[model samples]
Target: MSSSIENEYFCDGLTEEIINALAKIKELSVISRASSFYFKNKKTTTKEIIEKLGVATFIGGSVRLSKKKMRITVHMIDTVNDFLFWSETFDRDLEDIFKVQDEISLFIAEKLREYIGHIEIEDKLVEPLNLSINTYREYLKGRYYLMKFDYESTLKSIKIFEEIINEKPNFPNPYLDINQGYAYLGTMGLLPADEAFQIAQPYLKRALELDLSSPRSQLNLSWIECWQNWDLQKAYEHANNALEIQSTDEVYLTISSYLTVEGKLGPAQNYINKALELDPFSAINHHYKGYIYYLQQDYKKAIQFLQKSLTFNSVLPFPPIYIGQSLLLSGKFNEALEYFDGLKGVSLKDLTKLGGKTMSYAFLGDVSKCHIGIRELETYLNTELMGKALTFLVLTNVLLGNYEEAIDYVELAYKNKLPIILLFNTEPILKPIKNHKRFKKIMIQAISDNSNYTPIKRYRHSLLHTEDISKYVKEMEQVMMENKLYLNPNLSLKDLASYIELPTNYVSQLLNQGVNKNFSEYVNTFRLNEFKERVIFDENKNVTIMSIAYDSGFNSKTVFNTFFKKKEGITPNTYLKIKRRN
Candidate 1:
């Protein structure tokens, strides 16, 4: 695709370098490379690419290499206005390719931060690589085949990547790719999850050995622990470690998945919202966002985002299942049946398909077909030994009105530490039976077993004595009521700690333990109370709501209203009007 002697070696590589650099900035929503480079070599207009990819802008340019010297031209195009934000040309010798690549990537990031809203580009976008062009090309070639996504292509990519590992045993990236290759194989059902993750672990272990601090490496181990070992505790630990290091979309999604299965719907939705912000165009993130809504009983929004996810990738595992369930939950039984039967992307072997068909039949009151689907699901699980599919059986049982059977599965799942047991508390279908004595007992036991991570995962491990926490709570309440520390609009845990003359850790622990709220929640509770008191008073009627809100330490109107509704079950304006009238 190039006329020069060293054609495109730097161009394609440089593009990938730019993508890598930008992806590290969690503030910017950079689509994954597979989605970003989807426009490569295609005669697609900038408008079409941005619309399809749901991006604001993109980087594009060309490279022409004639012997040791290369001429590179690059520009940022704002797809909305269809004009150049910035452009630059570099004429440089190819001897120091790593330096050139890093410099160019950094410059592009600088330009992006300048053009776009405030982006904190503190870290270098691209890392230094000391290697031959051949090694880098081989790595790119493996990536090329890996992205092809076919079985043979993945095998070829894995083989090439392993060869690189043998050649450069110290390099971490190839090992990581191999880990991903096996992960993809497992996710696509080409291999058993156990076998695939087992094969992937050694490579991931090497990656960890090379860079023990890598969040990505920790995330991969988290996946292995969750899916293969069924160890949610260990998985949560590794994932929490990764989250402490990086806030990437992948880390957010994985943590969200764990929280969702654990029936922590509120925190689950919060994490998925973060993921969607960082990778808005990702079908999986959208699917998760929909699933969160479905669990929270918001069928309309559930169906909306699930359908949106399907528009991007029709075959995502969860959306089709949940969209159908959402429709059925809305009493569109016939429509649910039609939708379930019409999905071409769902294979009969998929857990999603199995669960969807069973639930759809049951929702439609087709007892015969429901029983038939149940038999099929049981047979599939018994014959294949799919631990992951066990949750679907529990779901199907619940919808079929087999309360005793459902309870039995919950006990079995709890015995095996199947995370699906955690779902019984929040699962919409299980709402009717949630009060069953045996079910409640099992759920209580399960919850007691799993450590609560919200509020303070770290400080809870090394807690102050109960009396010490209670003493601090008294001190905090006294300080809040008298000094009104919550009046500071920009108050923080550290700031509140200073007012009480306590260590920040002890204050956080006391807030979580004795007060049963985090610092923000505790302060916001006081702020909301203050706002309510002001609004209800007879004399303060003429002031604007936002002005009063600011006086009460609720700086952002959005935050004030959101907290008001979350606590009072009505918008601030509605509450204000009703209170004045009363």
Candidate 2:
């Protein structure tokens, strides 16, 4: 990167934009922003990065933002053969950043056909962020903090995004990102799920009205409908929509959870399996898998997977609660009590801390302690956090042998449209009332049939041969040799592509695959060759090297020297010294 120190934010934002755009293409297995950015500023080989990330290819780049102009030099490398797949340098006005991102994503998709099979690239991914450069910089700052993925950083992101909302109220991304920040807080139990979603819903609605296709928007909206609104059917529908646009572990997990709540365990297992396949080490996926088993009354497998999930992420709030319940359901009362006793400060939620203890004490015949938890829950019912305690209250009553009271709570849960009832209703603790006439009536009333759902069909284009790019490659070479276009200091990929009367993607594909260099490397090779030709002449000897560099189509002094050193393993001055002596 070359610019004021502040442009680092701009550079990060540009990269994230490209990642975001490419991730929208359903067929491409684009790496996450955090995962790919891990190699930034690290001294790592291309093969190591590709293998470590488990990707077939990867893109790397340099960016320069000066005043209103932006330059991005990017390259894609094929991991299998260790060869350059495609690369280009984009030069555009700062406001045209969205256009540049879309162009790169589409071109990459076109080039990746041989590696990943046919991919569908949309016409656009990110909406045009129509803001002053300064405002855009602020938005980037917000995104930078948001990607940190911690409580304090997420809250910081929320505040910054709030400021953007105040200044540029119509920009969809800031609105969407504000929702994302709040969503992280809600899920981590730092904030009440109801409160967090309520705070973000207005902003989220505006963002969706502006652009509903963003992957984050769809996922966030689905969660809101599930957790906040209790509209499980609509939640499943939104999740399906998001998966169709971009199949991610998050979307797959969300669909799995929704399917689980509908008592569709087979489909739920399939979705969760897909989620785990994508992100095998994710603790959340493990937790959901365990929860699915717990619902199936398989207490032993439930405890095993839940314990595995806690090993990955120890502070996760609900796994401990469920593990205790699983232990009790397995008839290990002492183990259940011990597990509940060991949960010192795993969560801030009062219900999570109390539910397991209350149930453990009930089975142990400690009536006083059990009622103490029951009283604490009753008090919670009178507070603003009322929705938090109902699920646990139902389970506690069942464990206390108050099957009738548990049934009453079930009716209340159904009246309030709680989505998790169908799921936990399958718990072994509920076995006594699960088949009761009244319980059966409520079960019928609680679950909505989302089984008829079908996702948006992902269409693939007809395949093309790998050797087909050879024709365009030769045409690009002929155009370059005839026009001496490298002499133009301000040339870009678009300009060269236009001169050859080929689409920009076609020319870039050719240069990257056939010529084996990016646009910057390809053009700079010509200029470097031109520089060498001129510098050796007696007429140019008296002329300064810098002046000859300009005459040879080298634009910036930094770029010229850097490219020369990288290619020749020495500076231009040293190269001139060696050549002139010979």
Candidate 3:
């Protein structure tokens, strides 16, 4: 059953109560709150919801509350044939809200049982809650703030939950919610892990003491065990207990992340798929799906899912960050640079944003800018944000061809037990040094105690490899020379390969092996040579410098200047002035 309520402090909580009540029917497979609430205010057809959620029937409704009265209107729809099976509107006094909820839940359950075949209604399914309306209102407000999913909002929710706990010391819901808020803050790098987990421990324990059957309490305990104590068995036990109670999308995604770090890709993929199925429109689920594909080195699918995530929530910086990383790895350096440049004015100032800029500049051969970002990241080394900052620094160094320093940072991250190091074995950004003895040794140590330890394998072959390197090299040079392909500002490796009737991988290999340069460097070498001949040798005496650059395949003047300075140790104008003086 999916429902929304208006003009009430505890609208979401009331909706969740109805869904949970219906889920108690042992015969019915209920759509979880995460899946149902995903369509709260969105305009969607019943068929679309059914197909996405895999439900045969759905309940939709809203509640309106006045000062002293409440009205709830609900409708049941059979998605198979788009028929309204049953519906009703009920008016009741504010004091009878709990009774109204019970009536609605039982009425729907009985009607559904009659329609689909009779099933016995158990006594345990309708346990009475002994909560006051004021306490419930506060609990709902806490839930509302928690759903915002930001560090500040989470902190606010924790404050609200703490107030509730003070007023009603026996309330288990607020205790569980406070633990979840702390977990979110710690996991997202917004708070120190030690500080967050230390504060959360008592709340978690209290919640379980009050309500031993609460799945959320178990889930929160699992996170603390896995991340803080590193107790895999206990963590698994708690996670399993939570899943047995309810297999919600958040729980599935959490388990997927745990499996990913353990190098259990197959099982992780299953959980991630389940998460997407349960919450298809969730940007976070899509982001994690792309991230899992990325860890598996499936760059094509990684970029596809990451792009889809951006379409859902462009305000999020992580999707674009992953997309840029995927393009850089696929040898589309120019495209990746363009994407990074487009994020110039975004408000996000986190390590992801800085890392994207650093890696893009490093790959594009802008060493000064890359180092600037590195220095900025170094400022966070002594601060509480060291884990996140250092992880990105490692990525930046890898792109800058500073493998030794990258390994040094990896060692530090490992020593600190940062969770980001869990991806060391499968992260493509660290692939250049995957075969390094030190890197392999560190990876072995990182997961040595875990049962699922696997050796990190080096990628022996390029994604685009050909046996006849010299043949492709000659063909590539001829195509560039005869067609003057470098004159096209928008030329890409795919375009060049299509023009020469060669495979993209073959062209990439020729550039990497025969020329000792990537696609971007190979193309820019020609452009720089053209610029030198035209400007330094006075081949274009009457043309402006910008026009000469534009004619020589450089799209942006700033990029042309930066590339020229990086290659020649001087800007284009300075180089020209020196040549003329000579």
Candidate 4:
């Protein structure tokens, strides 16, 4: 009898100890048992496993015990072609069971090395496990629970993994698995990026050092570098290295999605294609491919691809929002509205709010309602709503003849680091702003911030004295400082313009051109900055962020927190803790 590597190792009735043992082998890339066992009982074909696990080779075997003796058999299969590379069986008395494990591991490692024409130093260093095989059983149970992906189960798994690791610190797999959990938290945006990276990186680094060719360690490190560090170039290089070492797996596809986020549409598309060839049913690759098309503004093609993506995920809200927008832009207005209606309660606001409403209004030719939606979008932009709202604001403002407002939105969008505007070189909404030197400068800055490209021009203040336009609006920084206008609760662009004896039109233009922000944003950024500074410096004041918001001239604490979190990437309390730590 043998263990199946799934919930049950042996069929019929057999009682042999089953230990999930990985090799102490050095160079061959191995997927960690915890991650690999997820597919143990899966009905997926071998080709599917090759793509999903990204492992080129898979091994299966069974063990049986009778009369105080252990008999074992193992088979090695090539995943890409479903070819059997080797098969073997061994028999040993109970006293020699430990020797049996060591011999089998060494035999497999040496045989593979000779077959592949290279040998690597064994990297596995075993730490003693204090518990019975029952402890290992609990660990496997924890893995099963964690794979269910519920909060409670994950926490249970963490506790189990911690217990195991505390008992065996040198056991590399548990450290790697726990680190994967932290990385998952970071990816889900549940934890702060810095904190998550701090918890995950060291463990992953150690895992790699312990097993330099372990595909799991490489996968985790590459993903952390891409997602947490935002080092796309390094991520690309690491992912390429991992793929070269072992091709046909989920790790490569996961890394390719990062490239898509960076707007490397062509490369991302090609990499995902390779990923799908290895694992044809991977929903993630299809989902990301749809996003690349969406970025390219191919609404029809994007819709088609995204629809196929939905077949892979029928319930994800994000893809539907993209589909709705494509439908609206493609003139299927009623159908678009239906999709929006479908998202009423289920949608995340930042995903659907401004874009859905604005598209609906614009498609219906309800200019007044469209402008109302635009105002709401502006309000959201000034406060904290990001993503599609920012994208819609940048596009809609320009389309609505609000050129100065478009530039202002562009500046704020750039500051927020929205990718849509950063990719504006190919965007059409930017056409109205393209010829204006001010808009060009804003685009350049956005591109630089997004792409880190060289040759980006800085945002310039309005030229008060130009040859064709000899008129000049006096600079407003001193005026703003004198009145403390930015911090004033009742302050508005109109009030500031009136105070300076300048027309509101001229003031708006000057703010966008000179200050590179809309009136609301220009004021809010200063307010938020001041709020942050005071929160740090005024420890004796015993002030809450709410109180600070009012004192700093913000009318709403909600607005204050929204803007604060966006700018700082953490809650006020967390920021305070970080400040205290420093």
Report the number of clashing residue pairs per model.
0, 0, 1, 6
List model 2 lDDT by residue over 1-582, tens digit each: 775656888787778777767767766666655556657778998787777767767778888887789888888775664656456788888878777777776666655543343344455666666787788888888888876555667789889998988997778888888887877665444555556767878888899998888677888888887666657778877887887777677888888887776677888889888777655556677888998899887888888889888776566666887798888888898888888887775444446667777888888889998899888877866454454576677777887778888888788766655444555546667777778788888866655554465655665543324676777666777787799998998677769879978665466556655766767778888999999899999988889989999999986676678778878999989999999889
lDDT of 3: 0.74
Candidate 4 lDDT over residue span 1-582, tens digit each: 434443242211111112122332323445543334445456877666666766666766766766466777876775644556567888876455444555666555544442232333232223333444445555666565555433445567778888987776766766777787766644433343345557877878777767656555667777765565555556665665565444443654765576556556777677677665544544455666676677677888878777876565454445666687677767787788777766644433333645676767677677898888887766654433444466677676665677897778677655544434434554533666788988778655443334332211223344343431223333476677677787787675558768877755465556555655656567787787777778777563577768877888887665566667768889888988888788
Question: All candidates' lDDT scores?
Answer: 0.73, 0.74, 0.74, 0.59
TM-score for candidate 1: 0.64
TM-score of each: 0.64, 0.67, 0.70, 0.49
In model 4, the clashing pairs are 1-63, 2-62, 2-63, 3-9, 4-9, 54-249
* Candidates 2 and 3, the one with greater TM-score: 3
Candidate 3 lDDT tens digits, 1-582: 223343455666667777777765545567766667777668997788888788787888887777777778888876764567567898888677677777788777755653453333443444455677777787788887887666666789999999888888987888889888887666655665556777888998898999888777778887876676565556677777776665567777878877877768888888888777757777778888998988887889999898887666565546777788888888888888778777754543346667677888888898998899899989988776676688779998988889999999999877776666666667878889999999988877665455442212212354444557767777888889899999998776668879878655455556666777766567778998998888865557677888999989987665677668779998777887788898
In model 2, the runs with Cα more than 4 Å from the true position are: 1-15, 34-53, 60-77, 81-107, 114-126, 132-156, 178-198, 228-233, 280-283, 297-315, 330-336, 344-347, 363-365, 415-428, 461-582
Indicate the residue-level lDDT of 130 in model 3.
Answer: 66
What is the lDDT, from 0 to 100, of the residue 310 in candidate 4? 59
- How many times do residue backbones clash in model 2? 0
The global Cα lDDT (0 to 1) of model 4 is 0.59
Q: Which run of 10 residues does model 4 get worst, by summed lDDT?
A: 11-20
